[model samples]
Target: MANAGQKNRLVAVHLDESIGRGPPDIEHERAVAIFDLIDENSFAPVGKEEGPYKLNLAIAERRLIFDIRKEDDTEVMTHILSLSPFRKIVKDYFVICESYYDAIKSGSPRRIEAIDMGRRGVHDEGSRLLQERLQGKIEVDFDTARRLFTLVCVLHWRG
Candidate 1:
């Protein structure tokens, strides 16, 4: 059952196609993250009450853009955040993910597990940073933040 707070969740999410798709694994991750995020999340732009919003995330002019709208496509607000704070974390995440993928190919179970743990740790760090950055603008739970961070990483994908 959903509480009243859950009413503020996101009903739709879209990534700008112009951003260019990543490799197969990256695409899969992006799809899964979008599915999980829409399935369950708590998202409310600060000082706003009505919701079940729609979000279109994009990276333009080196800025991370959050295009928030009402369910009916009415524009609510757009937030453009600097990407500088996330550069290091995003780079670190990609490095760890590469190691994790390689480990899954032939490495021992123990090695794979260790790499996965490190990946999750880096993911959590990114999630926390996202929450901090959106502190005064948007309110999101940790899980939502994590999922959003995943989408943010997808937007940063160059391959």
Candidate 2:
């Protein structure tokens, strides 16, 4: 059972083939984000529908594709979002993440904490942007938005 506004939650999350394989860290993040999301999330597509949804994430023709389905695997919706708006933030997020990871190895605790704070800021911005973009199509909470944003960034990987 879910709250009134959240009758649909994601029961399954899949990444598309075209997104390509990622490095171990990226793969780990993807796996963990999806796991955390499915374990607890509230995603309800706008309309008179009830679901535990299945989501397939991919990128095609310079657009981010969300192939959404129902619990029984019936198609629900396919929402395509432009990636242009996210390019800068995603790039910044990657740079900050790299810095943070490196800081853990060599930088002082203060330096590591500073870099981590920046990293979290960028992640939060990405999540906010995602929620704004998803305004009419889907509804998700901040934590869900954050996890979904991680998957989006993972999909943005070129190699």
What candidate 1 gets wrong by more than 4 Å, as runs, is 1-5
Q: Indicate which candidate wins on lDDT.
A: 1
List lDDT for all candidates, in order: 0.93, 0.87
**Pairs of residues clashing in candidate 1:** none
Tens digits of lDDT, candidate 2, 1-159:
233345578888999876578887788889999989988787878883888789998888878898899878899888999989999999999889878888888999999999999999999999999999998888888999999999998998876
Model 2 lDDT vs. the true structure?
A: 0.87
Q: Which ten residues in a row have the lowest lDDT in candidate 2?
A: 1-10
Candidate 2 wrong stretches, greater than 4 Å:
1-6
Error of 1 at 124 (Å): 0.3
Angstrom error of the Cα, residue 99, model 1: value is 0.7
TM-score of each: 0.96, 0.93
Question: After aligning candidate 1 to the native by TM-score, how far in Å is the CA of 14 from where it should be?
Answer: 0.1
lDDT of 1 at 147: 98
At residue 134, candidate 2 shows an lDDT of 91
